[model samples]
Target: MPKSKRNKQVTLSKTTKKGRGHKELIINGIRDAAEKYSSIYVFNFQNMRNSKLKEFREQLQSSSKFFLGSNKVMQVAIGRSSSDEIKPNLHKVSKLLRGDAGMIFTNLSKEEVERLFNEFEGYDFARTGSIATEKVELKEGPLEQFTHDMEPFLRRQGMPVRLNKGVVELVSDFVVCEEGKPLSPEASRILRLMGNMMATFRLNLVCRWGSEDDFELYIDGPGDSDVE
Candidate 1:
């Protein structure tokens, strides 16, 4: 009988997993960008929104490059110690990639970068677990903003709402969310329905490194501390 190959097992030893390949790409990219751009900045973000980030990246694509991925991989790309650093004092910048952070390699001046970072802010709807920025209350009256068909949906979200003659009515005063408190899932949904946005996405420069030996820390930036 001919040799059967149907049950043969194939070895994956020569195959690289997608994740590992991606990490390698990121590492190589950072290293290349390091050599291309004169300045590198470590930045941390809050309330991240991918759409806004994509837009921001597009705007700076001509003069800068951004690297965001596994912190460990990024650390390795720039080196984690004085001995292994790809550039002088880059190990210090690696230490700043501890949390929700990334790096930007840019040819722009410090003033220009600072102004851009300070001015760039993206706002969107608040999600559950986010702190409510302000109290949102619905008074006991017809909610003209919502249609009558949304009464059931509103009620399901814990809103004291009902259909009153083809209109959505609040049966009683409803406190959707309180300022300074963590927003609940119900509250988040209600806020979305009411077109309320409470989340602000912004980036803060943690540190900056020059191609040579120059390095500086932004004391007011996020993750400001001694290099680990």
Candidate 2:
């Protein structure tokens, strides 16, 4: 064979080997995730810039119980597995896979995972594109209406609402979800409140786990006479 032809064959072989290695790594990651975690959250982030993506990844790592590999590789590994328990959740997750996607696996229950997500809610201030479920944007109409309705509800919870240049703001720290935009001062307070409430609920559930007291707490709110 000519020298050029020989070189081409070697390059193709190397490329094929690299692809196989990557697939193996993905399969391994999925197996590990399944073995270690009872719950998984698959997030699809689209059009995120490099810097923002890095920040998001770092945030997830710090907050999540465990963050795993890409969806494509994990899907293949999951497909081969015999576990039916996570299968349903994984199938539902499959639908969310689009653009640049990632998975978070955790031994923590669904409620716990949700609490983590809520905790990390507003860490990234800038709009780094959007998730498939909620698109972030800046506008005037519905967001204003939402802010109006939310203000009273927030105050009832012992939180205050402030207005910044015609925009409603939360006086106390809270988690604010408007049309998906994360606005500071006003909106940040709302989001903080919501996140705190979710954390409280999760803590209550965890405290009452595996007892008749827990059952009563679940059926009715805390302070049930039978619980104690």
Candidate 3:
């Protein structure tokens, strides 16, 4: 073989070795993460500056239950696992690969997770990016009916609206939703409140373990008799 050909082969070998080492490290990290956490939420962000990303990282760090990992490494780690439970949900995570991703690991029940998501939904982080998911069209459907019913509810919440250029806009100077555009902060706040209320009402438990009967003896009977 020529000298240049030998050097090229050596470089490729080094790259492959590095890739395998990183994959192994990520696999170990995934195993550790799975052992420590029962729920993981993967999120994607876009167009955010390094400062804003750092801010988000700091916020997640305060929670002490979140883990963010490199996509390639994580995928390798996940592939080595035999567990099918977490694997199925991993499909929803492909969207994260398209942009910046942060994974949240929590011991919270699914209802709690949904609540947290709803709470943060209204938070506008400098319009970093659009939800890469399919756009939720506001056609005639449950959402439409809810939006109609919510007009009064919004007004009650101090977000009155007015028709402007064939679109609804908040009347309050503090709350403005321009036509053919995304929601403003105040508008988003009201929407978040509504979403949280709906989510709370429709809370579904995704995964649950342990026995409720373990605490039964701590309570008194219906007749006020001690049931120790």
Candidate 4:
């Protein structure tokens, strides 16, 4: 019986936790991006289009970074609710991560961010629940765009249409959608039938936070007022 060497116990860092590697990556990325960019914006997006967002990211690769993920993970990444901020005063950004939001880290000025958002929006067909931009109505007449064979399909979409003289014709004046109502499936179909698109992709920079200053609210939209 000689001497037995004592075993060394090791503790795992937060980054090494199982199934949480992505969370750790988010935290590290936030810290690194904060150090590199002079401005950080909290943004809310309508209609998530992955491909378009990818292109947008590519356009800003030279000087900006976009971080979109679970709000809780992002809250943790920025050292929210604690003095252990990754970067000075930047942790306050986590408070704005409440709903349908993401983060933009950039060295671009406020004007530049506004310009980028204004010039770089994608438009698409409105989906169910999207508010109609204008009143959509199908007048009582032949629809020259559609052929007679599409009558049954159009009828199934709640349209009062029939194949008359080898063309789809509305039997009556059917109001597909109103200006302020949530679009129904039938309304969405009618919009496509008429070759109309109602969804306009947009981004609102609700708040901005810097490493040295507190949150500044952007009041271009409703309910964005900062509490005194």
Candidate 5:
């Protein structure tokens, strides 16, 4: 070979940097929503599920806009102090933006927001490392739920399974998961195969601020002077 081009130089150019402009966009979006809507609520989530959230968003797209991302950026959008806040008393809501939380800018009444948040809950499969809510055991008998071809897969997932008479059977009683224990990767897979759902996704409101007088909803949230 005459000239080798194995290590050819490749220059990559783009209009926007990784995180620089995105942060500005988020700040602008929150600030804009603050003016577009009458109230702002800080809500925290447990076991967040993006698909479920997407569905909720669609349902509220007509009256509300949700923002979830960097808490720092969101705090900045609403202002961390009274002096710089885009709207009056919004800084108080900003203080409650810590942890797995997001903001909802909506024109709906306060009662409506509270009722919807209280009622919405999504159940999904528990992932690895999530605590098991209940015990799941497979009896030592034919596993009619699984096909014969799934024998190897079941075995690889730590199930004591065998193919007997063209049926999948467990050689011994197997405890797939135990209550109050962190689920292993194998245990999570087995639970999904058995159609067990353990994770619950829900949103709890922290505080609200906007055109109306600011008030706190959840006192257990992190913040200063009952604001967080």
Candidate 6:
């Protein structure tokens, strides 16, 4: 089967309804991170890769920390209002905790942090429900990429393929995937077999806060415009 976002495991700490203590642990961790680091940022995480995120965390372990959990729990930890605020003006940071978001705390300078985020993005094969950035149409011809024995497998994926003289051949021009439409399970597999990569995974900055400054929103994102 083709890998897809549907199978991606999110890192946000999950807990049972009775495990409220887990929520408390996340809250305390967020508070500690806020106090320990000089600069704090809230980021919107969409279809973030778990393995790449682990690599990213390990790469920045010397000077940065990332915390992701339930949005409501984080909001409570940071304080959505002035009454239970964790730090001075932390409520500003809390406001950006909407959607699938997380916090990144770092001692690095703003310039260096921006550079790190820009350089740290990773790419992966587009999966099911992912849109094709470009059109991939295979003309009627021999497809030596597949072995002769794999003829049945190729045909099962909706390809009009046949083994001719121990070579897979497309009987007609096959539109594997069209631009801007969701790639089907079979199409995703075909795209990867054809070496087409369309998904660029990267984080987006929602807001940043510092001890001396107020939280601010950034529309530019984490410097990855190739993402859908």
| lDDT of candidates 1 onward, in order | 0.90, 0.44, 0.43, 0.80, 0.88, 0.82
For candidate 2, the per-residue lDDT at 128 reads 22
User: Which predicted model would earn the best TM-score?
Assistant: 5
Question: How would you order the candidates by lDDT, starting with the best?
Answer: 1, 5, 6, 4, 2, 3
How would you encode candidate 6's per-residue C-alpha lDDT over 1-228 as one tens digit per residue? 866888888889976684788888888888898878998988876556888889988988999999887889989988888777877778767766777788899999888877877776777888899888888999999998888887898899999999888899999999999999999999999888878878887887776788735556675445323211
Cα shift from native, residue 55, model 4 (Å): 2.6
Clash numbers, per candidate: 0, 13, 0, 0, 1, 0
Error of 3 at 132 (Å): 17
lDDT-superior candidate, 1 or 4: 1
For all predicted structures, in order, the TM-scores are: 0.89, 0.37, 0.36, 0.83, 0.90, 0.85
Residues 174-199, model 2: lDDT tens digits:
32333445444544444444332211
Against the true structure, whose lDDT is highest? 1
Of models 3 and 5, which has the larger lDDT?
5
Cα RMSD for candidates in order: 5.1, 15.9, 16.3, 10.4, 2.7, 9.7
| TM-score, structure 6 vs. true | 0.85
The predicted structure with the larger lDDT, 1 or 5, is: 1
In model 4, residue pairs whose N, Cα or C atoms come closer than 3 Å (at least 3 residues apart or on different chains), thus clashing, are: none
Off by over 4 Å in 1: 1-17, 220-225
Summarize candidate 4's per-residue lDDT along 115-169 as a digit string, tens digits. 9987888778889899999997778999888888888988898888988778788
**Root-mean-square deviation of Cα positions for candidate 5 versus the true structure, in angstroms:** 2.7
TM value for model 2: 0.37
Worst 10 residues of 2 by lDDT: 198-207
Q: Between 3 and 4, whose TM-score is larger? A: 4
lDDT of 1 at 11: 89
Error of 2 at 91 (Å): 3.6
